[model samples]
Target: MMTLYGRRGWGSVLIEAQLAYYDLPFRFEEVDDLFTSASARKALARINPLAQVPTLLLDDGRVLTESAAITLHLADLTGRDDLVPGADAPERAAFLRWLVFLVTNLYPTFTYADEPTRFVADATAAKAFRARVDDYAQSLWRMVEHAAAAPWFLGERRSALDLYIGVMTRWRPRRPWFLAEAPKLHAIAQAIDAEPAFAGTLARNFAE
Candidate 1:
């Protein structure tokens, strides 16, 4: 069985949801907060140099990091394009486009802002940096909102993009912001949140 090292409500939840969607058998290793715990980072670094969650140790022993890589890898392993568009599928290009866009364009905002002190030496500077990043993230979401298609990011078909929206909208500007400013993306997120297949997985990871 594979082992997934992650924390609840973190980026790892994204992979956890995908694994559940694929019905893949895996054991979860709960990691401590990467931002606040020294030992947690040290422990996870042995498995993943970056000490990042959602790190997957495949049954074959190969380690996979980065959510996008894992997302594609899972689809390849399952040979089912239910969540990811197949190579020749008409939605393939759009799926890849938005997938990359989410990871590269938007995900980094959280990385920088969530721990602004890591980048900005001064506390006051960190606050300013975080505020700017938040604003920039909002602008980036606007781009996604404009490109978003009804019912799903790709329209008429659900893909990993919906999963991404579901989790990401929970961060930074959050759901309320998306609901008001990016209703299309917000609708897609709501659809994923209501998906029965992910109910148990989400509940465990997002339990209050």
Candidate 2:
């Protein structure tokens, strides 16, 4: 069994999706908003110097951080490596490309959109920063729409990239401007949410 330390955020949702996909038995330790609290900070530092949630503690006492790394590690452990492309296969290169693309391009845009003030000191500048993020997010989703082969990011099988993209797509509708710009992504999100494991998790989390 694994113990997952997570908050109710995108990273946490990705961890949950991976657990469900792998049918891995695990305990969820809620990190909550106490990430800044002294105790939470101390405990996280002891496990991961980054003091990040979505940290996984393996049964053997090893700790894993970074959602992508954790998901890939769990896939390997459960012999579900087919969810990820094999290293020698052509799809493997594409898989790595999209995985990094989601992390570097899409994820950062969401982070900036969620917390605009972090990037700018002035209130006016922060609003402008948010606007820029909104634009970037739309462009990013359009890129995803072009790259996605339909049914899944990597075609039939659900990859870690799909889980990441699904979470982000679900989040877009909450933003008024981005929601209107993301029709294709919205469809992808619906498809992901319709999956039994994902729907079950959403129902449990949001009472849907």
The positional error of residue 116 in candidate 1, measured at the CA in angstroms, is 0.8
CA lDDT, every model vs. true structure: 0.92, 0.72
lDDT of 2 by residue, 40-135 (tens): 867767888877767889989998987768766877788766567766766788788888788778777766667677668799989998888878
Task: Please provide, for model 1 over 93-190, each residue's C-alpha lDDT reduced to its tens digit, 9 standing for 90 to 100.
Answer: 99999899999999999999999999999999999999999999999999999999989899899999999998999898998999999999999988
Segments in model 1 whose C-alpha atoms lie over 4 Å from true places: none
Task: Please provide the root mean square deviation of candidate 2 (C-alpha atoms, Å).
Answer: 2.7
TM-score of each: 0.98, 0.84
Top TM-score hit: 1
Off by more than 4 A, model 2: 34-42, 173-180
lDDT, candidate 1, equals: 0.92
